[model samples]
Target: MMVAIAQERDRAAFARLFAHFAPKLKAYGMRAGADPHTAEEIAQEAMVAVWRKAASFNPAKASVSTWLFTIVRNKRIDMLRREGRPDLREEDFLHLEQPVETQDETYEANETGAVLADRIAGLPDDQALVIKKAFYEDKSHRAIAEELGLPLGTVKSRIRLALTRLKTTLPDS
Candidate 1:
């Protein structure tokens, strides 16, 4: 059906695709915190993009549902950006100021961090690698699994073990 729409520009194929995905996309947007009206707009915009950009879709990279949902997500972000900031008042800035850190406090933080890094280095290579990817590099367990060609459960287990080891080794402040 997608191939038909992309290669032949078949309206029938597009109609069927839109019918199947539009409501699901709207529900997805709502679940992502969009109001009903915004969710509807997101669904419409995603369908329009599918009609326009169908040729760019690659089955090997993502399934049709994934592609459609990605389009909906992008459309929602664009709409939010265009909407711009809401009206702001003085109260909005009340919590903006952060207390300055003392020199001794900053030095203690750096020492603690160095000790933690050393402890992490002492872990088994697999556990250390997963811990660094999950925390320092801010990658999800699923992403780490994909990148390392490991199972998700293995990635998660390594992180859990690394955290337990770190907790035991680190002294309480």
Candidate 2:
């Protein structure tokens, strides 16, 4: 009955559909290794898609549960692909002109750098040192190792772990 109404774009049916399946979608995301917050966001997005696409749903070909889970699964795959892709490139900067350094812009840039430094400081001592050597000092991993009296592999791993932790902590730029 709800599915029929949803097929007709009934708002109440859509609300009922969301109420029933949103939690299951979130649980599915959690089981797929997303954090709880991320799971909730994924679930909400999936349900919103369901509402928008309900008119196309074919009950003869698939159960509502199967259709809904398929949406969640597809969204998760898309998220993984996006995560695997490198969205930013250093070479992309070559095409852009430098910003005029207004007083406000300069102040904001300094403040942002200070905040980033503080965040880097909050990392484990080894991680912080590796980040500083590699990024702040603009040294290559091999050069960082030679400077720090550490093996190249160790420096590489430390920098990688530091970057992962930093990504988890930082707001999206």
Candidate 3:
């Protein structure tokens, strides 16, 4: 019934499709290391693709679940590729600006640092340590693990889990 309605480009069919798969797709994104907001966006994008491509769906060739999962997987891969590519704007030196060293600026900078430090301290010790090593020390997970005498998998898992927890705990933008 849904397949026939979707084949005919019914709006209700699309809505039903989104209701059924969006949560599942978002879960998939979360498992793939994406934050909840990003996961929701990816799921919506995948559903839109499903709506647009419904005419091409062949139930005999593949189930709707398989098609939806494939779309979500491809979207995630595309997002990762986009993130791995350096931003051209950042690469261009024209956008760079020198900071003004006024008294107010110095005070603001110190306050910002204090706030950041407090936030980091509030996190679990393991998470704080991993984040510090990755960002402050600019070290790779493998290097950090070796330096700490920890297994590489343990380090990676800790970081991933920390990020997931942070995603939920941090205030939404």
The estimated TM-scores of all candidates read 0.47, 0.44, 0.47
**Taking the tens digit of each residue's C-alpha lDDT, what string does model 1 give over 29-87?**
67656789988988999898888887876544444654564566567667755664444
Q: Which residues of candidate 3, in runs, are more than 4 Å off?
A: 83-173
Each model's lDDT: 0.68, 0.64, 0.64
Sort all candidates by TM-score, best to worst.
1, 3, 2
Q: Which digits, one per residue and each the tens of the lDDT, describe model 3 over residues 23-101? A: 8788777766788998888898888888766666554444355456567766776774455533332111222133222
Which residue pairs in candidate 1 have backbone atoms (N, alpha carbon, C) closer than 3 angstroms, thus clashing? none
Taking all chains together, the TM-score of candidate 3 against the true structure is 0.47
The ten-residue window of minimal lDDT in model 1 covers 89-98
Residue 116 in candidate 3, Cα distance off native in Å: 44
Error at 85, model 1, angstroms: 15
Off by over 4 Å in 1: 82-173
Which lDDT value does model 3 have at 72? Answer: 73
Of the pair 1 and 3, which is ahead by lDDT?
A: 1
Task: Give candidates' CA RMSD values in order.
Answer: 20.0, 19.8, 19.4
What lDDT, from 0 to 1, does candidate 2 have? 0.64
